[model samples]
Target: MYSPALQPLFQSLLSTLADLNLAYDRDREKLSESMKDANLRTRALEKLKQQHHERREPYLQQLAILQDRIQRGWH
Candidate 1:
């Protein structure tokens, strides 16, 4: 078994993941607005797309760190 201190850290990471997921969902909704009745402006859509792309690397890095901590006993 791992240290008890790791529990809170794990919880915090889980919370962070949840928040990130919401941010991702919000970005996706903005990207999808064009498909729906709402007209997403080209400039605005491009900006949002760029923002999402920029966030991709950091989010994936965080996910990888969390997964590593999980399988590697919080090393």
Candidate 2:
């Protein structure tokens, strides 16, 4: 029941609000996707770190043996 002059202004406001809502939803979806990507990267990095530590165990054992030999004057 708005005045004729005010009808266009009300319609314009409604259109603007609808556009803002759509933009907000799109941004929310993008943020969720980004969080998923970050979690995947974090899991990958953790796996690599575990593998690196596992690979170093043998080298460490060798180094310890060499250290013992040097201390005993066997090399």
Q: Across residues 1-75, which tens digit of lDDT does each residue of candidate 1 receive?
A: 656766776677677667766897787676676555445456666776677667565756776776777688874
Could you tell me the TM-score of candidate 2?
0.48
Name the runs in model 2 displaced over 4 angstroms: 1-36
| TM-score for each predicted model, relative to the true structure | 0.48, 0.48
Off by over 4 Å in 1: 34-75
lDDT of each: 0.68, 0.57
In Å, residue 26's CA in model 1 sits off its true spot by 1.6
| Tens digit per residue, CA lDDT, model 2, 1-75 | 334554454465556556655765565555555656777757655665566556555555655664565567652
